[model samples]
Target chain A: MSLVKTIKELKEEIKRMSYGKDISIGFVPTMGYLHEGHISLIKKAKLENDIVVVSVFVNPTQFGPNEDFESYPRDIERDYNLSISGGADIVFNPNVDEMYPDGASTFVNVKGDITNKLCGKSRPTHFEGVTTVVSKLFNIVKPTNAYFGQKDAQQVAVIQKMVRDLFFDINIVSCPIVREEDGLAMSSRNVYLNEEERNQALILSKSLFKARDMFLDGERDANVLRKFIIDNINTKELANIDYVDIVDAKTLENVETINSKAIIALAVKFGKTRLIDNIYLEV
Target chain B: MSLVKTIKELKEEIKRMSYGKDISIGFVPTMGYLHEGHISLIKKAKLENDIVVVSVFVNPTQFGPNEDFESYPRDIERDYNLSISGGADIVFNPNVDEMYPDGASTFVNVKGDITNKLCGKSRPTHFEGVTTVVSKLFNIVKPTNAYFGQKDAQQVAVIQKMVRDLFFDINIVSCPIVREEDGLAMSSRNVYLNEEERNQALILSKSLFKARDMFLDGERDANVLRKFIIDNINTKELANIDYVDIVDAKTLENVETINSKAIIALAVKFGKTRLIDNIYLEV
Candidate 1:
C-alpha cells in the first residue's frame, strides 16, 4: 500500500502499475473521518478489483453558507489505518489547492427535477458540488469501477444519472449501508453527538425500523407512513426534523403509494449537527 | 481506416488497438464537412500520436433557435475519403441519438468572462454545448491528446480552460488556421454561400490581412487597428458587420492597445451566411 499526495505522482504511479497489463481499479471517494460505512466500500472494492484507490477529500464546494464546512470532523491518522485495514492499495489524499487550483471554473452539473428534491431542496448547490468533484476524481483516477455507499441514496442516484448522461466509461458500484450494532447508521458526524444527544439519536433508527416493519405489514399509504415517521422523531426533544420524504428510490420523485421501489429518507438536526438516514422499500 | 458509428464499437476498437505496449491516441473532433481546416487537425494528430481518431458529429445544442442547425453541411462519404487521405486511423460517426440518448441531461460548463466574450456574445449557449459534447467525447475516446483548429480562437481558449479546471488527463493541441488560396478562412459553413456572397465574403479576410500588415508597421492602438479592419470590410456593400474588436489572445478580454499578444477578430454576414475571421498580433 502506498500513499500519494499529488495528482502527477498518482497518475505516474497508476501508469506504472497498468503499463502493459489489464489492471482493474476500484475507487472509493469520501470526506476523510473514516467509519465502518467507508470501510465497507473499500472492502468490497478490494474483493472485486486488482487495485483499490480511496480518495479522502473534504470538498468545501459541497457545503452551503450556514453548513458545517469549517467544523467538519477530520482525522487523517485514524483514516489511514482504517483504509489500510480495509485493503486499499493507494490512499490519494489531496489538499484543496491540489484538487481545485486557482482559476478552476469548470463544473459538471446534472440538472432537472432529479436535482431539485430531497437533500437538494435544503442545500440547493449540494448535488452540483458532488457531481463536479466526482467528475474531477473520475478523470484523475480513471477507475474501472467506483464504489459509493447507499447511505447517501440520493447521491448514488444522482451520480448514477451523471455517469449515464455523460457516458462515462466506468461502472458505478453502490454498496449497502453499514450500521452500528444499536442500529444507528454509521456516520462521520456521529462524533458531534454528545452523551445525551448520542442516546437520543437512536430514535432515528428506531422510527425507521418501526416504519420498515409497518411497510412490510401492508402499510401502503405514503401520507400515513410519512406521518408516523415524523411523529416518532418528534418524540425526542433533541431531535429536530429537517424533512421526511417517501420518494421513488431511482427517480427521487414523490410516490402516492408504495407499489414498487421506494426509499423513506430523512434528515434531522440533533443540536448543531445534521445527520441523514434512509430505508429502502422494495417490492 | 475503419469508420465506426456507435460509441461502443469505437471504444472497443480503441481498447483493442491500445491493449498493451504504450499506444497514444490523438483525437480531432469535427462536424464532418471535411475541409482543409479539419484535415489540418487530423494531419497534426497523425504526426504526433500512434493512432488518430476523428469524430464527425454535427452537434445540435451548439446551434441556437434561429441559427442554421438544420441546414448545416454534412457529407460522410467525402469526410471518410479526406480522413483516410489525412492518415486517420478511425472515424467515429455517431448519430445524435447515439451521442445524446434519451434522458441525457448532464452538462459541462466553463463559467466567468472566458465564455461570455467573443463568439459567446452572439451565441449565448454555444460554449456550454461545445464543452458538454467535448467532455463526453473525451471520456469516450480517452485520447492521449486532442486537437482543435485555431480558426475558432475563443473555442480553443475555452476548451483549454475546461481541461485545466476539470483535470482531464489529456493534452490539448491547438493548430494554426487553414485558409483558402485567396485568403478566406476555411469553414464547413462556407458551403452556405452563393457566388456573389462568396466574392463579398473575401472582404472578411482581406480586411484582417490589411490590419495585420498595419499592426506589423508599428501601429499599437487597438482602436486604430479595429477601425481600419472595420472600414476595409464595410467597403463591400454586401457585407454586414456583426462585430469587429481587438482582444487579448489568451484572456479574450478587450484591449485598448496592442502591447502584447492580441487578436483582431470579426464576424460578418453576406446574404444569410455568417463568416468569421481573425488575425493575431504578436510582439
Candidate 2:
C-alpha cells in the first residue's frame, strides 16, 4: 500500500484511481494504533470495494482538554503494516496541522438530544467533535461506502443521524464489534492499562454480559438490570463506576422497561484509565 | 433543461450524468427570484463546465427573524426560463420542507473572527446559517466548481473559510456583481422597491463609486472615505443608512487607512426596501 501524509497527495492519488473507470472506493477512518477491530473493518472494506483507502488521523478536535489527547498511543510502522496486510491501497496519515490549520474554525454539530444520552453525558462535546472530524473525513475521502466498527455504538448512531441530516451520498456500514476472548471490548486505549488494571477492566464487559444473561432469563425491569450490573462492578476493588444505564438502541433515551430494542451500556474508571462496554438486549 | 423539485430526483439526475464518464459539474445556488446577477453566475458556470445546475431556494435559516423571508420574491416559471436561457442543464427548486425535512438537526458553523467583522456584526448567526446551507448544497450537487456573485461579498469570504476548514473538495468561483445602467447592484430584492425607492437605492452604488474615485485621487484615510460615502447616502431624502464602512478587502476588518486592497460596502433602506453595494479599490 502507498502511504500518503498530505491532503494534496491523497487527492491526487484519488484522481489517478478515477482516471479510466468508475471504481468503487471504500474507506476506513481511524486514529493510528491499529488493532483487530480496525483490521477487520479494513478487511471488510477490501472485500467490498475496488479501491480501499484508509486514513489514520489522530484528530485533536475529537479529544477533550483533560482527556488522553497527549497520551494516546501512536506507532506508525505497526499501523502501516496492519493496513497493508488488511488490503488498503492508499493509507492517508495527516498530521494535526494538515487536518486543522492555524485558522481552521468550521464545525459540524449533530444535535443534543440523541448525543446527550450515552457517553455524551460525561463527554458533552465528544460526539460533536466526532461528527465534525468525521464530516471533514467524509468530504476529504468521498468514498462510495465508509466502514465503521460497532465498538463505538453511540458514534455509529451519531454518524447515521449526521449523514441523514446532511444528505451525504455515502453508505455508512457499522461493522460488528471485535472483542477479546475474555469479553473485554477491544480499544486502542487498552494499551494504557497495567496488568492488574487490565484484568479489572474485564469487569466492564463481564457485567454487560451478565446483564444480557439476566435479560434472556426474562428480567424486564430496566432498573433491576442497571442495578445488577452496577453491583457486579462494585465487587471489584479497582473499578469505579462512572455511569450505568439501559437506553433505547436508536434514540438512546433512558428506558424504564425493556419493551423494545434496548442496549445496556456502562463506563468505569480503573486508576486513570476509563473503559466503556455495551450489549444489545433484544426480545 | 429539467426542473427537479425533489432531492431523490435530482440525485438520480446527477447519477445518470456521472455514468461512464468524468464530466465537470458547475453549480449556481440562489434564492428564487433570478436577476441578471444570477444569470451572469449561471452563464459563467455554463462556460466553465460540462453540466450547469442551478438551485433556487430561499433558504430560511440564513434570514433573521426580522428579515423579509416570507416576502422574498420568487417566481418558479420566471426562474426556470431564466435558468434555461442562461444555459443551465438542470434547475433544482426544492421546497422548504424538501431541503429541511423533519428531524433535521445538524448544522455547519464557521467561527467568529472574519465572519464577525462586517455583516456578521449586524446579523449575528447569518454567516453560520449561510455556511450550513451552502455546505449542504455542495454535498448534494457534488459540483466541480460552485459560483457565487460578489454582490454578497461577506458571503463569499465566509464560504471560502468554510471550504478550507471543512476540506470540501470543490472549487468556489466568485463572479463579479451585475448592475443596472444607473449603477444599482442587481438583486432579486430590488423588485420589492417602488420607483422612488429604486431611484433612491442607486445612492448605495453611487457613494461606493465616489469613494473609489477618491481612492484613485490619492485618498488613503479610511475614516475620511467612510464619511464621504455616508454623507453622499445622507443626501438622498428617502435613503436610511444601515451600515457604512471601509474595510480590508480580504479580511473585511475595518482599516484606518487604505494602503493595499480595500472595499467600501454599505447597506441602506429606502421605504422598507434594503439595498447593498460595494466597490473594490486597489492602490
Candidate 3:
C-alpha cells in the first residue's frame, strides 16, 4: 500500500523486501488512469512473483508533436487504491523529473521491420519511448518476470524483441487484453469519448469480431480478409478508419495468404480520440 | 575469489552484498586483458561507489568481419587479481553465451553526428557494437555510477548521450586515458603491433602532441594543423596514414579554424594492424 516516488526510495524499499534465494519479482508498468486492463496486468504479475511492483508513468517521449501528451489523463490517488486492490505489493509512481531529469538524452530503439509496421507507422517514436521507459523500469525493479497486456500488441512485440536482443535476465509475460461488456477494448482514452461516441466506438471491436468470424468460416486470403474488415469499419459513420491490415502475428508483416498465424489490427478515430483494437487468428 | 558464470548466480551474490542505504554502485565494463587502462577505470569506480562491479565481456557484437574476435586476449585469473587489487568488489565475467544467447535480435544505437566521425568511419558497425554491449552491461550491473576511459573519447561521448537520452539512472564518469612511458595510449590492439611496429606506432600519439603544440603556439587554422600532422606521418616510411582530421570536439564535424575546442584524431596502419590516437585542445 506504500507509494515510492523516487528511484532511490524505490530501490531501498525493494532491497528490504524478503526476496530470499531464487525469489521471483514481478513487475507491471503503466501510464496511469488505471482501468480494468491495467488491473489485469497487475493481477497477473501478483500471481507469478514473491513481490509485485507496479509503476505508473506518463512518459512524454512516446508522444509526437501533434499527439495528446499534454492532455493525457492522470489520477494517482485512484490508481494507487486500484493497484492495492489488484494485489500489487508496491506502487512506483515517479514524477516526470524523477523518471527523466533535465538535459537527459539516452534512447533505446527496437530496430528493423518490426518497428516500421503497425502502430509504428502512425506514431514513429512511440515504441522508442515505450522501450526506453520499459528499460528504465526494468533496471529499477530488476524483476524476475514482467507483465504486459496484449492490448498494445505492437508494444508487446517490440518489448519482447528488445529483451531478447539485449540479454536482459527477466521473463516478459504477456496477458490477454481486457474488454468492456460491449466488446470495446478498455483504454484510458475511452474516457475522452462522449456517450454517443462511446456507442459508435464499439464498431472497432465489432469489425475485429467480423474478421474473426471470416477466419472461423475458413477464409484465409489476407487481402480479402483485410478488405472485409476495412469495408465494415468504413460503413460506420463515426468510426473513421486509420489503417486495416492482416499481418503475420509474429513478424507483423503483411501476409498474402494466412496459412500460419495472422493478426487483424486497426486504428479508428472517434472524434478527437483514437482507439485501436486487434484480433489474432491462427490457422 | 569465487568465479560465477551464470547471471542467476551473479544476481544472488550481488543481493547478498550490503550496499548500505544511500550507497552508490559504480561499474567498469571491459574485455579482459588486465591493462593499466582498465585498472585506472576500476580505481575510479571504487572511489565513486560504495560497491564496485567490473564486467569483463569480450563482446562479439563489437567485432567486425576480419577483426580479431577469436584472437582477442583474455586472462581471467590475471584480470581477477587486477580487479581485486584495484578495489573492485565484484568482477562480472560472463561468457559470450551468457551475455548473448542464440538468436538475439536487439541493438542499442547512440545516434547523431558523433557516431558518423572518427573511429566510426573505418569501423562502421563498431560503435553500434560498443553502444549495444555497453547498454547490456549497464542493464545487468544497474550501477549508480559507471566509469569509462577517455582513451575511447568518442565512445565516452556516445555513452554520455545514450545514458541521458534513455533515462538510465547512472552517472557516466569519464577518466583520463592511461598511456605508456613512450606516450602510446594503452589498448588491447596495441598487442597486435610487432616490436618495430610498436616503435613506429608512437607517431599516432606524437602527431596529436604536434597538433597541441601548434594550438598552444596560437595556430588558428584547422586545415594547417591537420596538414602538419598528415605531413609528419607521411614522412615515416613504416606508417600509412588512414585518416587525419582536425574537427570540433563535441560535434566531430571538420572545422575551418581552431578558435574553439577541437579534437585532432588519426588512424595509422602499421604493417597489418591499425592504431588510433587523438588529442582534445581548447583553442
Local lDDT at A239 for model 3: 79
Ten-residue region with minimum lDDT total, candidate 2 chain A? A112-121
Regions of candidate 1 where Cα sits further than 4 Å from its true position: A18-20, B19-21
Clashes of each: 0, 0, 10
Report the number of the highest-lDDT candidate.
1
Ranking by DockQ: 1, 2, 3
Residue-wise lDDT of candidate 3 within A142-261, one digit each (tens)? 889999888888888889889877767789998888999999899999989999889888888887888789889998888887888788777778877778878887778789988887
Query: Could you give candidate 2's per-residue lDDT for residues B151-200 as a string of tens digits?
Result: 89888878988899888989999998899999989988888899988888
Error of 1 at B218 (Å): 2.1
Which has the better DockQ: candidate 2, or candidate 3?
A: 2
lDDT of 2 at A188: 94
| DockQ class, candidate 3 | acceptable
Q: Tell me which residue pairs clash in candidate 3.
A: A104-B164, A105-B164, A105-B165, A106-B162, A106-B164, A106-B165, A106-B166, A107-B165, A107-B166, A165-B106
Model 3 lDDT tens row, B1-283: 3456777777666777754344578889889896899999998888878888888888898888988899988899888999999998888899888877765657777665677777888788888899888888877777888999877778887888777666567888888778999999999888888898898788778888977887899888888888899988887788988788777766677898777887787888999788877788885
Worst 10 residues of 1 chain A by lDDT: A13-22
Give TM-score values for chain A, per-prediction.
Answer: 0.98, 0.96, 0.97
Deviating ranges (above 4 Å) for candidate 2? none
